[model samples]
Target: MPSAPPPVPPPQPISDLPHLTRSPPLPDFFLAALSLFVFLSSSSSRSFKLPLLCIQSNPRRFLKTPSMSFSHPNSGRTPHDAHRLHPFASPQSLSDWLKPRLPSDSFASWGVKPGTKNVHNLWLELSEGETSLADSTPPIRTVQVLSLRIIDNHRRILLESHQQLSDGTLRNRNRPLSEKMKPNETPESAVYRAVKEELGSILGDSDCSEIVKIVPDSYKMKIEERNSASYPGLPACYVLHSMDVLVEGLPKEDFCTVEEEEYANSEESSIADEAVSVKKHFWKWVSLDSLDF
Candidate 1:
Protein backbone atom coordinates (compact mmCIF):
# COMPACT_ATOMS: atom_id res chain seq x y z
CA MET A 1 0.00 0.00 0.00
CA PRO A 2 2.89 2.37 -0.71
CA SER A 3 4.03 2.19 2.94
CA ALA A 4 1.40 4.80 3.91
CA PRO A 5 3.48 7.52 2.20
CA PRO A 6 6.05 7.58 5.02
CA PRO A 7 3.73 9.27 7.50
CA VAL A 8 3.61 12.52 5.53
CA PRO A 9 5.38 15.14 7.69
CA PRO A 10 3.49 17.61 9.83
CA PRO A 11 2.89 21.12 8.55
CA GLN A 12 5.67 23.41 9.84
CA PRO A 13 3.74 25.95 11.81
CA ILE A 14 5.36 29.36 11.08
CA SER A 15 5.84 30.09 14.77
CA ASP A 16 7.77 26.88 15.48
CA LEU A 17 10.39 27.56 12.88
CA PRO A 18 12.53 30.33 14.33
CA HIS A 19 14.09 32.89 11.96
CA LEU A 20 16.75 35.02 13.71
CA THR A 21 19.22 32.80 15.51
CA ARG A 22 22.78 33.12 16.88
CA SER A 23 24.88 31.99 13.95
CA PRO A 24 28.24 32.58 12.24
CA PRO A 25 30.15 35.89 11.71
CA LEU A 26 27.40 37.98 13.42
CA PRO A 27 29.22 37.88 16.81
CA ASP A 28 27.62 36.83 20.12
CA PHE A 29 26.78 40.35 21.34
CA PHE A 30 24.54 41.26 18.39
CA LEU A 31 22.82 37.91 18.68
CA ALA A 32 22.05 38.56 22.34
CA ALA A 33 20.74 42.04 21.66
CA LEU A 34 18.25 40.64 19.14
CA SER A 35 16.31 39.26 22.06
CA LEU A 36 15.64 42.50 23.89
CA PHE A 37 13.74 44.59 21.34
CA VAL A 38 12.72 48.14 22.24
CA PHE A 39 9.46 48.30 20.33
CA LEU A 40 6.69 50.84 21.04
CA SER A 41 2.97 50.16 20.67
CA SER A 42 1.43 50.66 17.24
CA SER A 43 -0.05 54.19 17.01
CA SER A 44 -3.28 52.52 15.85
CA SER A 45 -6.16 55.03 15.97
CA ARG A 46 -4.53 58.37 16.79
CA SER A 47 -2.27 58.81 13.75
CA PHE A 48 -0.56 57.09 10.77
CA LYS A 49 -4.07 56.40 9.52
CA LEU A 50 -4.12 54.10 6.56
CA PRO A 51 -6.58 51.75 4.84
CA LEU A 52 -4.62 48.53 4.47
CA LEU A 53 -1.49 46.35 4.89
CA CYS A 54 -0.50 43.97 2.11
CA ILE A 55 0.18 40.28 2.65
CA GLN A 56 2.81 38.33 0.73
CA SER A 57 1.51 34.75 0.51
CA ASN A 58 -1.89 35.70 -0.87
CA PRO A 59 -0.94 38.59 -3.11
CA ARG A 60 -4.35 38.58 -4.82
CA ARG A 61 -6.49 39.42 -1.78
CA PHE A 62 -4.37 39.51 1.41
CA LEU A 63 -4.63 43.17 2.21
CA LYS A 64 -5.04 44.12 5.89
CA THR A 65 -7.45 46.99 6.24
CA PRO A 66 -6.92 49.39 9.13
CA SER A 67 -8.82 47.55 11.84
CA MET A 68 -10.56 50.00 14.14
CA SER A 69 -8.43 48.54 16.97
CA PHE A 70 -5.13 49.02 15.13
CA SER A 71 -6.02 52.66 14.43
CA HIS A 72 -6.64 53.47 18.11
CA PRO A 73 -3.75 53.01 20.55
CA ASN A 74 -5.95 54.07 23.41
CA SER A 75 -8.57 51.38 22.85
CA GLY A 76 -7.72 48.01 24.44
CA ARG A 77 -5.46 46.25 26.96
CA THR A 78 -7.70 47.13 29.90
CA PRO A 79 -6.04 49.41 32.45
CA HIS A 80 -2.71 47.57 32.27
CA ASP A 81 -0.88 50.84 31.51
CA ALA A 82 1.95 51.53 28.96
CA HIS A 83 5.29 51.34 30.79
CA ARG A 84 5.18 47.54 31.13
CA LEU A 85 4.62 47.01 27.39
CA HIS A 86 7.18 49.44 26.05
CA PRO A 87 10.45 50.33 27.81
CA PHE A 88 8.46 53.53 27.90
CA ALA A 89 7.06 52.74 31.33
CA SER A 90 7.51 51.37 34.84
CA PRO A 91 6.36 47.87 35.98
CA GLN A 92 2.80 47.28 37.18
CA SER A 93 0.08 45.52 39.30
CA LEU A 94 -2.93 45.95 41.69
CA SER A 95 -0.27 45.63 44.44
CA ASP A 96 0.09 41.82 44.60
CA TRP A 97 0.07 40.08 41.15
CA LEU A 98 3.78 40.26 40.33
CA LYS A 99 5.70 37.04 40.12
CA PRO A 100 7.18 35.34 37.08
CA ARG A 101 7.12 31.77 35.72
CA LEU A 102 7.79 29.79 32.58
CA PRO A 103 6.38 31.07 29.24
CA SER A 104 2.99 29.45 29.72
CA ASP A 105 -0.46 30.76 28.83
CA SER A 106 -0.18 32.51 32.21
CA PHE A 107 1.88 35.27 30.57
CA ALA A 108 -1.26 37.25 29.83
CA SER A 109 -0.43 39.59 32.72
CA TRP A 110 -1.21 42.67 30.67
CA GLY A 111 -4.71 41.35 29.95
CA VAL A 112 -3.93 40.87 26.26
CA LYS A 113 -6.96 39.36 24.51
CA PRO A 114 -6.71 35.95 22.83
CA GLY A 115 -6.41 35.20 19.14
CA THR A 116 -9.74 35.27 17.30
CA LYS A 117 -8.56 36.01 13.76
CA ASN A 118 -6.76 32.63 13.76
CA VAL A 119 -3.54 34.15 12.39
CA HIS A 120 -1.57 30.90 12.58
CA ASN A 121 0.64 30.75 9.49
CA LEU A 122 2.80 33.88 9.55
CA TRP A 123 6.28 32.50 10.19
CA LEU A 124 9.50 34.08 11.51
CA GLU A 125 12.85 32.36 10.91
CA LEU A 126 16.09 33.42 12.60
CA SER A 127 19.71 32.32 12.11
CA GLU A 128 20.60 32.92 15.75
CA GLY A 129 20.16 30.60 18.71
CA GLU A 130 18.55 31.29 22.07
CA THR A 131 21.79 32.20 23.84
CA SER A 132 20.52 34.67 26.41
CA LEU A 133 17.58 34.71 28.80
CA ALA A 134 15.73 37.42 26.90
CA ASP A 135 15.77 35.67 23.51
CA SER A 136 15.00 32.24 24.92
CA THR A 137 12.55 33.49 27.48
CA PRO A 138 10.35 36.36 26.29
CA PRO A 139 7.70 35.66 23.66
CA ILE A 140 8.27 36.34 19.94
CA ARG A 141 5.40 38.27 18.39
CA THR A 142 5.64 41.54 16.45
CA VAL A 143 9.19 42.69 15.67
CA GLN A 144 11.11 45.90 16.35
CA VAL A 145 12.85 47.55 13.38
CA LEU A 146 15.37 50.42 13.38
CA SER A 147 15.82 52.94 10.57
CA LEU A 148 18.48 55.67 10.71
CA ARG A 149 17.68 58.18 7.99
CA ILE A 150 20.55 60.42 6.84
CA ILE A 151 20.22 63.83 5.25
CA ASP A 152 23.29 65.78 4.00
CA ASN A 153 25.68 63.81 6.26
CA HIS A 154 25.29 65.82 9.50
CA ARG A 155 21.71 65.01 10.61
CA ARG A 156 19.95 61.76 11.52
CA ILE A 157 16.42 60.58 12.21
CA LEU A 158 15.51 57.26 13.79
CA LEU A 159 12.45 56.55 11.71
CA GLU A 160 10.07 53.58 11.73
CA SER A 161 8.09 52.48 8.67
CA HIS A 162 5.82 49.44 8.11
CA GLN A 163 3.09 49.19 5.47
CA GLN A 164 0.72 46.25 5.57
CA LEU A 165 0.95 45.49 1.87
CA SER A 166 -1.95 45.26 -0.53
CA ASP A 167 -2.81 41.62 -1.24
CA GLY A 168 -0.86 41.72 -4.47
CA THR A 169 1.77 43.92 -2.86
CA LEU A 170 2.43 42.00 0.35
CA ARG A 171 5.55 40.42 -1.07
CA ASN A 172 6.49 43.73 -2.69
CA ARG A 173 5.37 46.30 -0.08
CA ASN A 174 6.07 50.00 0.56
CA ARG A 175 8.66 48.77 3.10
CA PRO A 176 9.06 45.03 2.79
CA LEU A 177 11.53 44.79 5.66
CA SER A 178 10.38 41.28 6.48
CA GLU A 179 10.49 39.80 2.97
CA LYS A 180 13.36 39.20 0.51
CA MET A 181 15.61 38.79 3.51
CA LYS A 182 18.72 36.59 3.37
CA PRO A 183 19.07 33.16 5.00
CA ASN A 184 19.00 34.47 8.56
CA GLU A 185 17.08 37.75 8.40
CA THR A 186 15.50 38.15 11.83
CA PRO A 187 14.70 41.53 13.35
CA GLU A 188 18.29 42.58 12.68
CA SER A 189 17.95 41.88 8.98
CA ALA A 190 14.71 43.85 8.89
CA VAL A 191 16.58 46.84 10.31
CA TYR A 192 19.34 46.61 7.72
CA ARG A 193 16.90 46.13 4.86
CA ALA A 194 14.85 49.14 6.00
CA VAL A 195 18.00 51.26 5.98
CA LYS A 196 19.13 49.99 2.58
CA GLU A 197 15.73 50.54 0.97
CA GLU A 198 15.39 54.08 2.37
CA LEU A 199 19.08 55.14 2.22
CA GLY A 200 20.66 52.89 -0.45
CA SER A 201 23.89 51.73 1.22
CA ILE A 202 25.58 48.86 3.00
CA LEU A 203 25.55 48.58 6.81
CA GLY A 204 28.90 47.12 7.67
CA ASP A 205 28.67 44.99 10.81
CA SER A 206 28.20 47.67 13.48
CA ASP A 207 26.35 47.98 16.78
CA CYS A 208 24.02 50.99 17.10
CA SER A 209 22.58 51.64 20.61
CA GLU A 210 21.79 55.28 21.40
CA ILE A 211 18.11 55.57 20.42
CA VAL A 212 17.44 59.29 19.94
CA LYS A 213 13.68 58.80 19.82
CA ILE A 214 10.78 56.37 19.42
CA VAL A 215 8.82 57.12 16.24
CA PRO A 216 4.97 57.24 16.04
CA ASP A 217 5.21 59.40 19.19
CA SER A 218 4.05 56.50 21.37
CA TYR A 219 4.66 52.89 22.44
CA LYS A 220 1.05 52.13 21.66
CA MET A 221 0.54 50.51 18.27
CA LYS A 222 3.78 48.75 17.40
CA ILE A 223 2.70 46.21 19.98
CA GLU A 224 2.33 42.75 18.34
CA GLU A 225 -0.86 41.22 19.61
CA ARG A 226 -3.28 39.06 17.69
CA ASN A 227 -6.89 38.18 18.28
CA SER A 228 -6.13 34.85 16.63
CA ALA A 229 -4.76 31.37 17.33
CA SER A 230 -1.92 31.43 14.80
CA TYR A 231 0.26 32.87 17.52
CA PRO A 232 -1.84 31.20 20.15
CA GLY A 233 -0.89 30.69 23.82
CA LEU A 234 1.80 33.31 23.17
CA PRO A 235 2.16 36.57 24.98
CA ALA A 236 -0.82 38.68 24.01
CA CYS A 237 1.85 41.25 23.23
CA TYR A 238 5.38 40.26 22.25
CA VAL A 239 8.01 42.99 21.92
CA LEU A 240 10.01 42.62 18.73
CA HIS A 241 13.63 43.70 18.43
CA SER A 242 14.72 47.31 17.61
CA MET A 243 18.03 49.20 17.24
CA ASP A 244 19.76 52.58 17.35
CA VAL A 245 21.06 53.05 13.81
CA LEU A 246 23.28 55.99 12.86
CA VAL A 247 22.47 58.44 10.06
CA GLU A 248 26.03 59.11 8.98
CA GLY A 249 26.39 60.90 5.63
CA LEU A 250 22.72 61.87 5.19
CA PRO A 251 20.85 62.62 1.96
CA LYS A 252 18.64 65.41 0.59
CA GLU A 253 15.58 63.43 -0.52
CA ASP A 254 12.36 63.90 1.46
CA PHE A 255 10.58 60.53 1.94
CA CYS A 256 7.91 61.46 4.49
CA THR A 257 6.75 64.78 3.05
CA VAL A 258 3.47 65.06 1.18
CA GLU A 259 4.40 65.93 -2.40
CA GLU A 260 2.88 69.23 -3.48
CA GLU A 261 0.75 67.42 -6.05
CA GLU A 262 -0.67 65.02 -3.45
CA TYR A 263 -1.85 67.73 -1.07
CA ALA A 264 -5.16 69.67 -0.78
CA ASN A 265 -4.14 72.75 -2.81
CA SER A 266 -6.99 72.68 -5.34
CA GLU A 267 -6.60 76.34 -6.36
CA GLU A 268 -4.48 76.67 -9.52
CA SER A 269 -2.31 79.53 -8.14
CA SER A 270 -2.03 77.73 -4.81
CA ILE A 271 -0.75 74.72 -6.68
CA ALA A 272 1.88 76.75 -8.50
CA ASP A 273 3.23 78.51 -5.41
CA GLU A 274 3.15 75.33 -3.33
CA ALA A 275 5.06 73.60 -6.08
CA VAL A 276 8.18 74.20 -4.03
CA SER A 277 8.31 70.83 -2.33
CA VAL A 278 8.90 70.93 1.41
CA LYS A 279 10.39 67.85 3.01
CA LYS A 280 9.03 66.64 6.31
CA HIS A 281 11.95 66.80 8.73
CA PHE A 282 11.95 63.51 10.62
CA TRP A 283 12.69 63.61 14.33
CA LYS A 284 15.24 61.39 16.12
CA TRP A 285 12.82 60.04 18.73
CA VAL A 286 9.86 60.93 20.92
CA SER A 287 9.63 60.12 24.61
CA LEU A 288 6.85 57.58 25.09
CA ASP A 289 5.72 59.26 28.29
CA SER A 290 4.58 62.51 26.68
CA LEU A 291 2.16 61.15 24.04
CA ASP A 292 -1.50 62.03 24.88
CA PHE A 293 -3.43 60.36 22.10
Candidate 2:
Protein backbone atom coordinates (compact mmCIF):
# COMPACT_ATOMS: atom_id res chain seq x y z
CA MET A 1 0.00 0.00 0.00
CA PRO A 2 1.15 3.54 -0.74
CA SER A 3 0.55 6.71 1.27
CA ALA A 4 -1.33 9.68 -0.22
CA PRO A 5 0.38 13.00 -1.04
CA PRO A 6 0.09 16.04 1.28
CA PRO A 7 -3.08 18.14 0.94
CA VAL A 8 -3.01 21.73 -0.35
CA PRO A 9 -4.02 24.85 1.57
CA PRO A 10 -7.47 26.30 0.93
CA PRO A 11 -7.66 29.26 -1.45
CA GLN A 12 -7.82 32.74 0.14
CA PRO A 13 -11.27 34.24 0.57
CA ILE A 14 -11.39 36.94 -2.11
CA SER A 15 -14.75 37.92 -0.63
CA ASP A 16 -12.96 40.81 1.07
CA LEU A 17 -10.79 41.87 -1.86
CA PRO A 18 -11.31 43.51 -5.24
CA HIS A 19 -10.16 42.12 -8.60
CA LEU A 20 -9.37 43.47 -12.06
CA THR A 21 -11.67 42.21 -14.80
CA ARG A 22 -13.44 43.71 -17.81
CA SER A 23 -16.45 41.46 -18.21
CA PRO A 24 -19.85 42.26 -19.75
CA PRO A 25 -22.79 42.92 -17.41
CA LEU A 26 -24.55 39.63 -16.71
CA PRO A 27 -27.11 38.97 -19.51
CA ASP A 28 -29.72 41.80 -19.53
CA PHE A 29 -30.53 43.23 -16.05
CA PHE A 30 -33.99 41.65 -16.49
CA LEU A 31 -32.73 38.07 -16.46
CA ALA A 32 -30.10 38.82 -13.81
CA ALA A 33 -32.77 40.22 -11.49
CA LEU A 34 -33.90 36.70 -10.57
CA SER A 35 -30.41 35.73 -9.47
CA LEU A 36 -29.95 39.00 -7.60
CA PHE A 37 -33.00 38.24 -5.45
CA VAL A 38 -31.81 34.87 -4.19
CA PHE A 39 -28.32 36.16 -3.54
CA LEU A 40 -29.60 38.98 -1.35
CA SER A 41 -32.14 36.80 0.41
CA SER A 42 -29.72 34.00 1.07
CA SER A 43 -27.58 34.11 4.22
CA SER A 44 -24.37 33.86 2.24
CA SER A 45 -22.40 37.10 1.71
CA ARG A 46 -21.97 36.62 -2.05
CA SER A 47 -23.61 39.30 -4.22
CA PHE A 48 -26.63 38.50 -6.38
CA LYS A 49 -27.40 39.63 -9.95
CA LEU A 50 -30.48 41.80 -10.80
CA PRO A 51 -33.38 42.85 -8.57
CA LEU A 52 -31.14 42.70 -5.55
CA LEU A 53 -28.71 44.55 -7.82
CA CYS A 54 -25.44 43.80 -5.94
CA ILE A 55 -23.02 44.02 -8.88
CA GLN A 56 -19.48 44.72 -7.74
CA SER A 57 -16.54 43.21 -9.63
CA ASN A 58 -14.09 43.51 -6.75
CA PRO A 59 -14.81 41.59 -3.57
CA ARG A 60 -12.39 43.13 -1.05
CA ARG A 61 -14.35 45.03 1.60
CA PHE A 62 -12.93 47.39 4.22
CA LEU A 63 -14.56 48.47 7.49
CA LYS A 64 -13.44 52.10 6.92
CA THR A 65 -11.73 52.71 10.22
CA PRO A 66 -11.33 56.58 10.43
CA SER A 67 -8.31 56.58 8.08
CA MET A 68 -10.49 56.39 4.90
CA SER A 69 -12.66 59.19 3.46
CA PHE A 70 -12.48 60.54 -0.12
CA SER A 71 -14.43 62.92 -2.30
CA HIS A 72 -15.04 64.23 -5.85
CA PRO A 73 -12.96 67.14 -7.18
CA ASN A 74 -15.50 69.82 -6.42
CA SER A 75 -17.52 71.49 -3.64
CA GLY A 76 -18.29 68.79 -1.03
CA ARG A 77 -21.71 67.66 0.27
CA THR A 78 -23.26 67.01 3.70
CA PRO A 79 -24.26 63.76 5.46
CA HIS A 80 -27.92 64.73 5.82
CA ASP A 81 -27.87 65.64 2.15
CA ALA A 82 -26.53 62.20 1.21
CA HIS A 83 -29.21 60.34 3.20
CA ARG A 84 -31.81 62.82 1.98
CA LEU A 85 -31.02 62.20 -1.70
CA HIS A 86 -34.06 61.60 -3.94
CA PRO A 87 -34.94 57.93 -4.56
CA PHE A 88 -35.76 58.37 -8.24
CA ALA A 89 -32.07 58.50 -9.14
CA SER A 90 -30.80 54.95 -9.75
CA PRO A 91 -27.09 54.12 -9.97
CA GLN A 92 -27.38 54.30 -13.77
CA SER A 93 -29.13 57.69 -13.56
CA LEU A 94 -26.50 58.91 -11.10
CA SER A 95 -23.68 57.72 -13.38
CA ASP A 96 -25.44 59.46 -16.28
CA TRP A 97 -25.82 62.68 -14.31
CA LEU A 98 -22.03 62.84 -14.00
CA LYS A 99 -21.54 62.93 -17.79
CA PRO A 100 -23.95 65.78 -18.68
CA ARG A 101 -26.26 67.75 -16.39
CA LEU A 102 -24.94 67.56 -12.81
CA PRO A 103 -27.69 69.24 -10.83
CA SER A 104 -27.26 71.20 -7.59
CA ASP A 105 -28.76 68.34 -5.55
CA SER A 106 -26.35 65.96 -7.26
CA PHE A 107 -22.60 65.89 -7.92
CA ALA A 108 -21.83 66.55 -11.57
CA SER A 109 -18.88 65.05 -13.39
CA TRP A 110 -15.62 66.83 -12.65
CA GLY A 111 -14.04 69.09 -15.33
CA VAL A 112 -17.50 69.88 -16.69
CA LYS A 113 -18.97 73.28 -17.59
CA PRO A 114 -21.22 74.27 -14.64
CA GLY A 115 -20.18 71.71 -11.91
CA THR A 116 -20.67 68.10 -10.84
CA LYS A 117 -20.47 68.23 -7.05
CA ASN A 118 -23.88 66.85 -6.19
CA VAL A 119 -23.85 64.29 -8.99
CA HIS A 120 -20.83 62.75 -7.30
CA ASN A 121 -22.81 62.78 -4.05
CA LEU A 122 -25.21 60.09 -5.23
CA TRP A 123 -22.27 58.16 -6.58
CA LEU A 124 -20.94 57.94 -3.02
CA GLU A 125 -24.23 56.55 -1.74
CA LEU A 126 -24.03 53.37 -3.88
CA SER A 127 -21.28 51.94 -1.67
CA GLU A 128 -23.29 52.18 1.56
CA GLY A 129 -24.75 49.27 3.57
CA GLU A 130 -22.84 46.96 1.28
CA THR A 131 -22.22 43.29 2.10
CA SER A 132 -19.26 43.66 4.46
CA LEU A 133 -19.52 47.29 5.65
CA ALA A 134 -20.90 48.50 8.94
CA ASP A 135 -23.38 51.40 9.01
CA SER A 136 -21.44 54.63 8.34
CA THR A 137 -22.16 58.33 8.71
CA PRO A 138 -23.11 60.43 5.64
CA PRO A 139 -20.29 61.65 3.38
CA ILE A 140 -18.73 65.12 3.66
CA ARG A 141 -17.08 67.51 1.18
CA THR A 142 -13.37 68.37 1.30
CA VAL A 143 -12.33 72.04 1.42
CA GLN A 144 -9.08 71.60 -0.56
CA VAL A 145 -8.15 70.09 -3.89
CA LEU A 146 -6.79 66.49 -3.58
CA SER A 147 -4.51 64.28 -5.64
CA LEU A 148 -4.92 60.48 -5.19
CA ARG A 149 -2.39 57.88 -6.42
CA ILE A 150 -3.00 54.15 -6.83
CA ILE A 151 -0.21 51.59 -7.04
CA ASP A 152 -0.08 47.79 -7.16
CA ASN A 153 1.88 45.60 -4.72
CA HIS A 154 4.81 46.43 -7.01
CA ARG A 155 3.94 50.15 -6.98
CA ARG A 156 2.46 49.77 -10.46
CA ILE A 157 -0.28 52.06 -11.85
CA LEU A 158 -3.88 51.68 -10.72
CA LEU A 159 -6.04 54.84 -10.67
CA GLU A 160 -5.89 58.43 -9.41
CA SER A 161 -8.20 61.33 -8.40
CA HIS A 162 -7.96 65.09 -7.92
CA GLN A 163 -10.61 65.54 -5.23
CA GLN A 164 -9.47 66.47 -1.70
CA LEU A 165 -10.11 65.11 1.75
CA SER A 166 -12.25 67.15 4.13
CA ASP A 167 -10.40 69.26 6.69
CA GLY A 168 -11.19 66.72 9.41
CA THR A 169 -9.04 64.09 7.71
CA LEU A 170 -6.52 66.36 5.93
CA ARG A 171 -4.66 66.65 9.22
CA ASN A 172 -4.34 62.84 9.22
CA ARG A 173 -1.65 62.70 6.51
CA ASN A 174 2.03 61.83 6.89
CA ARG A 175 2.66 65.48 6.01
CA PRO A 176 0.01 68.17 5.74
CA LEU A 177 -0.30 70.33 2.61
CA SER A 178 -0.71 74.11 2.86
CA GLU A 179 -4.50 74.45 2.64
CA LYS A 180 -4.17 78.18 1.86
CA MET A 181 -1.84 77.67 -1.12
CA LYS A 182 -4.33 76.52 -3.78
CA PRO A 183 -7.26 78.86 -3.16
CA ASN A 184 -8.31 79.13 -6.80
CA GLU A 185 -6.83 76.04 -8.43
CA THR A 186 -9.07 73.12 -9.39
CA PRO A 187 -8.77 69.95 -7.27
CA GLU A 188 -6.91 68.03 -10.00
CA SER A 189 -4.19 70.64 -10.30
CA ALA A 190 -4.02 71.05 -6.55
CA VAL A 191 -3.68 67.30 -6.08
CA TYR A 192 -0.90 67.03 -8.67
CA ARG A 193 1.17 69.57 -6.80
CA ALA A 194 0.53 67.98 -3.41
CA VAL A 195 1.47 64.51 -4.65
CA LYS A 196 4.75 65.83 -6.03
CA GLU A 197 5.66 67.54 -2.76
CA GLU A 198 4.76 64.55 -0.57
CA LEU A 199 6.01 61.63 -2.69
CA GLY A 200 8.70 63.57 -4.68
CA SER A 201 7.69 62.37 -8.18
CA ILE A 202 5.96 64.38 -10.89
CA LEU A 203 2.93 62.43 -12.16
CA GLY A 204 2.72 64.38 -15.38
CA ASP A 205 6.44 64.19 -16.20
CA SER A 206 7.48 61.83 -19.02
CA ASP A 207 9.14 59.65 -16.39
CA CYS A 208 5.98 59.19 -14.31
CA SER A 209 3.74 56.14 -14.53
CA GLU A 210 0.65 56.48 -16.72
CA ILE A 211 -2.63 56.81 -14.80
CA VAL A 212 -5.53 54.58 -15.85
CA LYS A 213 -8.42 56.79 -14.67
CA ILE A 214 -9.57 59.27 -12.02
CA VAL A 215 -12.91 58.12 -10.74
CA PRO A 216 -15.10 59.79 -8.04
CA ASP A 217 -15.97 56.62 -6.13
CA SER A 218 -19.06 57.27 -3.99
CA TYR A 219 -19.65 55.85 -0.48
CA LYS A 220 -22.07 56.78 2.31
CA MET A 221 -20.91 59.24 5.00
CA LYS A 222 -22.08 60.07 8.51
CA ILE A 223 -21.65 63.60 9.91
CA GLU A 224 -22.89 65.90 12.65
CA GLU A 225 -22.18 69.56 13.40
CA ARG A 226 -19.99 70.06 16.48
CA ASN A 227 -18.57 72.94 18.51
CA SER A 228 -15.02 71.58 18.47
CA ALA A 229 -12.22 74.19 18.41
CA SER A 230 -9.96 72.07 16.18
CA TYR A 231 -11.73 71.55 12.87
CA PRO A 232 -11.92 75.36 12.16
CA GLY A 233 -14.88 74.29 10.06
CA LEU A 234 -16.87 72.68 12.88
CA PRO A 235 -19.04 70.60 10.56
CA ALA A 236 -16.46 69.10 8.23
CA CYS A 237 -17.17 66.85 5.28
CA TYR A 238 -16.04 63.17 5.51
CA VAL A 239 -15.73 60.96 2.42
CA LEU A 240 -14.32 57.65 1.10
CA HIS A 241 -12.84 57.56 -2.40
CA SER A 242 -12.71 53.99 -3.79
CA MET A 243 -9.81 53.82 -6.26
CA ASP A 244 -9.45 50.78 -8.55
CA VAL A 245 -5.77 49.94 -8.99
CA LEU A 246 -2.69 47.73 -8.48
CA VAL A 247 -0.09 48.76 -5.87
CA GLU A 248 2.38 47.65 -3.17
CA GLY A 249 4.84 48.93 -0.49
CA LEU A 250 2.22 50.44 1.82
CA PRO A 251 3.12 50.16 5.52
CA LYS A 252 0.19 50.90 7.87
CA GLU A 253 2.37 53.33 9.89
CA ASP A 254 3.13 55.47 6.79
CA PHE A 255 -0.42 56.85 7.19
CA CYS A 256 -2.22 58.39 10.20
CA THR A 257 -5.76 57.83 11.45
CA VAL A 258 -8.12 58.71 14.34
CA GLU A 259 -10.20 55.54 14.41
CA GLU A 260 -10.26 55.74 18.21
CA GLU A 261 -11.23 59.42 18.33
CA GLU A 262 -13.72 60.20 15.44
CA TYR A 263 -16.76 59.18 17.50
CA ALA A 264 -15.67 61.33 20.45
CA ASN A 265 -14.49 64.49 18.64
CA SER A 266 -17.75 66.36 19.08
CA GLU A 267 -18.56 69.99 19.92
CA GLU A 268 -18.24 69.55 23.68
CA SER A 269 -15.47 66.93 23.47
CA SER A 270 -11.96 67.43 22.03
CA ILE A 271 -9.41 65.42 20.01
CA ALA A 272 -5.65 65.87 20.74
CA ASP A 273 -4.34 66.78 17.29
CA GLU A 274 -7.53 68.60 16.26
CA ALA A 275 -6.02 68.54 12.76
CA VAL A 276 -6.02 65.11 11.04
CA SER A 277 -4.37 64.67 7.64
CA VAL A 278 -4.74 61.88 5.04
CA LYS A 279 -2.03 61.45 2.40
CA LYS A 280 -2.99 57.80 1.92
CA HIS A 281 -5.78 55.47 3.03
CA PHE A 282 -3.33 52.54 3.00
CA TRP A 283 -5.49 49.94 1.22
CA LYS A 284 -4.74 46.19 1.35
CA TRP A 285 -4.37 45.30 -2.35
CA VAL A 286 -5.42 41.69 -2.82
CA SER A 287 -6.10 40.25 -6.27
CA LEU A 288 -9.57 41.39 -7.36
CA ASP A 289 -10.53 37.72 -7.73
CA SER A 290 -10.19 37.32 -3.93
CA LEU A 291 -13.43 39.31 -3.79
CA ASP A 292 -16.50 37.03 -3.83
CA PHE A 293 -18.94 38.77 -6.13
On lDDT, the candidate that comes out on top is 2
Model 1: per-residue Cα lDDT over 186-223, one tens digit each: 44445444454433322233332221222333222144
Q: Which residue segments of model 2 deviate by more than 4 Å?
A: 1-142, 145-149, 153-181, 201-233, 238-293
RMSD of each: 30.9, 27.2
How many Å off is the CA of 87 in candidate 2? 41
| lDDT of each residue in 45-127, candidate 2, tens digit only | 67645466678985543333221222433435333333333332444564453333223332322313221222232233222
Task: Report the alpha-carbon TM-score of model 1 versus the true structure.
Answer: 0.23
lDDT of 1 at 174: 23
lDDT of each: 0.30, 0.33
The TM-score values for the models, in the order shown, are 0.23, 0.23
Best by TM-score: 1
